[model samples]
Structures are given as structure tokens and as C-alpha cells.
Target: MNQEALTFRAATAADIDAIVALAESAYRGDSGRRGWTTESDLLGGRRTGPDEIEDFLCKPRSMVLLGELGDPPALVACAHIAAHDEVGYLGLFTVDPTLQGAGIGKRVLEEAERIVRDDWRLSTIEMTVINVREELIQYYLRRGFRRTGKFLPFPYGDARFGLPKRDDLSFEVLEKTL
Candidate 1:
């Protein structure tokens, strides 16, 4: 992909559907299997629904950032940034499955950190990765985030968060100082 042509901007309500679709493509079904970022083996069901994306976009302290490419502009990448008191939280990150290994996700994450540091004036950007996702965790660690030894229970009963294929799944918090 042409990194020079890519533009990052705040996602609007109109982009919610595409955002959800992009996320599902990266982590949900057989479509997700095409990407290295897929969590299909660990979880089932939709990665994100329209209603959830809508709610996220509606949060006053939160904004969904999108990376678009091409002349007509396609939603190829996205990251969610939200103010959490003194720190900034990043989540709902996604990249088009076909575009995954091409460094789009790295750009999205860098932009997320930029937003947190410049816009939110926060010193830290934090995120949580599924505990068993060691490869994913190493990806973050390479980008300056460190394991904080903090863990949160994965929402097991909530289908909105995706249904677990295994019994032991939790999130390990990772933090990067901006």
C-alpha cells in the first residue's frame, strides 16, 4: 500500500458500518482466517456490531480514528482512542485483512499514540491484548508498550465481545509512555 496516500481522520457515524465490517474481516469468521491478526481460533461470533460501534462513536471522550486510502477513499484501517482520566486508552484497532502484513496496523497505532500525546496531552497510551495472544503481545512490545502485569477478565457471557472457544481467556494490559 502507498503510505504516502493514506490519510488519518476522525471516523463519523457514517463510517460505523464500514468500521464494523473491517473489524469483523480482521477477527471474526473465515474471512478473518486470511489475516495473521485473526482471533478466530480463540473466539467466535462478530468482532464488533453496529450498535457497539455506534455507542463507541457517541462517547464524548472517545473518537474512532480511521485511515483511508485511494482516490475514492476506502476505510482500510482504524483505532479507537478515549480519555480515561489521566491516561489514554486505545482499542478497537483494525486493518483490512488483505492489507494486514503491509504495515497498516503500525501506522494506525502510531497515529493513535500521536493523538493521545498531542490531542489528549496524555503521557501514556494503554491497551489490552488477549492473554494467550503472545505474538500479538510481542507486536505491541516492539512498539514500546510493556506488559503492566495487569489483567482483566474477558467478557465470557457477552456475545458482543465474542464467544470464547476456550475457557481460559483474559486480557493483559499493555502500556506505552508517550
Candidate 2:
């Protein structure tokens, strides 16, 4: 696929199912193994389903943005953003397994940040990543997010998140001033 043919915009309610499928294929299940983002070794089951995606779509001041690839009109990537307290939260980030490492993820993130800063008038952006995901954390840190050492316990039984592979699993918050 020619990435030069890509386009991006806020997702519509009709795009929710495809976005959810893309998220699942990029993060979990046999389909995810094709991409480096897969957590197959650490967790299992659906990453985000239709209902959760609908919540992203219906939330006030929040969105699920999709990047459309050419020909097939597929959503190759997505991110969820919302205002939280004093900062905007970035979540549900995913890139099609085949599209990872080609700068698409970074572009999606930049757009997400821009939306928070320009659209929401937010001064900061924040997100939580698994504490053990050192490389992933480094990826964000390099993007200017700072480590606050603050963490929230990973929801053990919440399939909406993921099942813990180890006892120490949890989320460390990362923040950046936009």
C-alpha cells in the first residue's frame, strides 16, 4: 500500500467497528502477531470492542480519529483523546501491524497532541503505559513526555484493559506540556 495515499480525520460512528478491528488486530489475537505491538505473550482476548469504541465516539470533547489508507479505505491507525482535569489524556493508540515503524504512529501521535493543544486548548497531555514496556515508554519520552513516577494499579480482571501476565504489571503515568 502507498502510505502517501493516506488521509486522516475524526472518526464517525460508522467507523467504530473498523477502528475496533484495527485495534484488535494490532494489539492482540493471532492477527496481532504480524505486528510488533502485539501483547500476545503477555495477555489475551479482545483489546477494545464495539461498545468501548462507541463510548469513545460518544464522549463529550473526546474522539477516536482514524487514518485512512488508500484503495481499501481502511483505518490504518487510531487514537483516543479526552480532557481530564488539567490535561488532555491520550489513549487507544494503535497502528496497523504492517504500518508500524514507518512514522505513521508518530504522525498519529503528533496529530493527537495537536488536537489536544489546538482544539481543546490544553496545556498538557498525559497517558499511561505499562510500566514494563520500557521501549514504548522511551518512545514517548523521546517525544517529550516526562516520567512522573506516578502509577495506577492495572485492573486485574478488566478485560477492557488486559489480563496481567505478571504480578508487578501496572501503568506509569507520563505527561508533557503542550
Candidate 3:
């Protein structure tokens, strides 16, 4: 896969299925374990479902981004960005397992920040990472995000959010000033 040929764009309702598959393969059950980004060991169930994705697509000020490649254009990666009052929220980020570490995610993150700063005209971008995902948090830290230490309870009993493998799971906020 030649990343140089990859293209980036905002996702549409038509992309929901591909985006769902990409996200699941990157974060969910055994299938996700094929990649370094798998959260399967920490959680069970689907990372996201069709309904939730459709909702994001319909939400105001929200955009789902996809990194695509090939003539038919397969979705190799995806992320969600939403405008807040004075900040941008980034979430649902994932790269195709095989494509991990190929600089694709870095480019996606950079483009995400660019969209926040330029498209949304926001000064700060915020995200929440699983508190125990130190490696993931560090990845963002390298990209200039700082840990806020503020934690939000993971949505328990919400199948839409996934089933936690442990009771202590929570999300820690991370923010970057654009």
C-alpha cells in the first residue's frame, strides 16, 4: 500500500459500513488483535455500531474523516471531529490494523488538527483516551497534547460504548492548543 497515494476527506452516510468495519478491526474483539492498536484485551463487544455512526453523521458540527486509497477507494482509516463552543473534540479514531505504524495515523491526526484549526476555527482540540492506554496517551502527547488528569466515567451498561473487561476503566481527557 503506497501511502503517498492516499487521500483524505469527510465521510458521508454511504461510508458508514466501511467506517464501522475499520473501527471494529482496529479496536474491538479478536479481529482487532491483528493490529497493535487493539483494545480487545481491555474491553469486549463492538467499538461502534451502524446506528451510532449514522447519528454522528447527522449531528451538527460533526464530521467523520476517512483516509482512503486505491481506485475503488477503500477506507484505510477514520476519525471523528466535532466542534465544541471553543474547542474541537476528536474521537473514534482508527487506522487499518496492517497500516498501523506506517505514518498514516500521524498524517490523519495532523489533518484532524488542521480541520479543527482551519475548518472549525478552533484554538483547542480535545479527546478522551482510556486512562490505562498510556501508549495511546503518549502518542497524543508527542503530538503536543497534554494530559488534563480529568477523568470521565466510561459509560457502563451502555452497549453502545462497549463492555469493559475491568470495572476501573475510565477516560482521561487530553487537549492540544491549535
Candidate 4:
């Protein structure tokens, strides 16, 4: 829970499994129910796979950041950031389900913004959140993101994204000016 106790670093190919596991635990299935971020009721199936994660790791101007704790360190938080022209895209954000709401997520977010702003030298950052997740939207709103009123239709038949449990699913674009 101590924000200072966490260390942040870019993830490598070796971290694909841990990142995928942490993402699954934070957003999918029964294990994700322990956190407020769980999408279990909205979707089913894998949140991410090794192939997708490896692709992110290999992409240029993209990074998978991991937040670790303890002496040798254990992956507890992670996010994917990618630069596209003048904007930075943020996704695959996860914090260990058991460790959610302890300010760790905030710290991880701050670090992500730092990378986007200072490292990438980008002036703006953007993300997509499920439109129905008001609480999650509010969380990002509190951190200075604003709804852009742009909606991306959820891939209904794509198991790669998830198995949508409802027909109303879609993503709303959120942006912040750094």
C-alpha cells in the first residue's frame, strides 16, 4: 500500500506471462471479482494472451510498464502505452486484484503519464473505457481525463477482446492534455 514501495520498469518479453496473469486477475472471471475493476459481469474469456503481449513488447514507440514490490520484486501492476503521431494511447492497465484501491493504481497511472509526457514528449494521452463503466470513467475523470464523446463499437464476435455478455457494450474515448 505504500506508494514508495513500488518500483516501475518497462516490461520485457520475459514478463509476458506475469503481465497476462495480472491483467486476467484484475479484469476477468471470478478472480477479478476481488477488485472494483472486474469486468466479469460484462464479459467472459481471456483478457489478454502471450502473443498479444509479445506483440506489444516488440512494437516500436510502445511500452509495457510493470510495477513491482518486494526485494526481488513481483509484478503487481502494469499498463501498455503506445505513441501514435502526437498522442499516446494507454491500455491493458491492471493492478493486482487483492491490492487495488491502495493508491497503487494512482501511482502506476502517474508513472504512465510521466512516460507519455516526459519520455515520449507527447502533449496528450488517450484511452478507451467501456462506456457502461461509469465508476471507472469517473476514476479517470478525477485524474483529468475528459470524455471525447467518441464511441468505438465493441467487437461483438471477437473472442480476442472478450465474450460480451450484453448487447450494449461499447467503448468511449477519453483524453487528457498533458
Q: What is candidate 4's lDDT per residue for 14-47, written digit by digit as tens?
A: 8999999999999998899999999999999988
lDDT digits (tens) for residues 1-178 of candidate 3: 8898889999999989988999998998777778888999888888998898998899988989899988888899999999978899999999999889999999898999999999889999999999999999999999999998799999999988888889989999999999
TM-score per model over all chains:
0.97, 0.94, 0.97, 0.98
lDDT of 1 by residue, 76-174 (tens): 999889988999999988888888888888888988998899988999989999999999899999999999999999999999899899999999999
**Number of clashing pairs per prediction, in order:** 0, 0, 0, 0
lDDT (10s digit) by residue, model 2, range 37-116: 78777777778889998887888888987877776587899999999876899988999998898888888898899999
Candidate 3 ranges beyond 4 A from true positions: none
TM-score of 3: 0.97
Question: For model 4, what is the error of residue 173's alpha carbon versus the real structure, in angstroms, after optimal superposition?
Answer: 0.2
TM-score of 1: 0.97
Please tell me which model should have the higher lDDT, number 2 or number 4: 4
lDDT of every predicted structure (CA atoms): 0.90, 0.87, 0.91, 0.94
Against the true structure, candidate 4 reaches a TM-score of 0.98
Q: Residue 96: error of model 2 in Å? A: 0.3
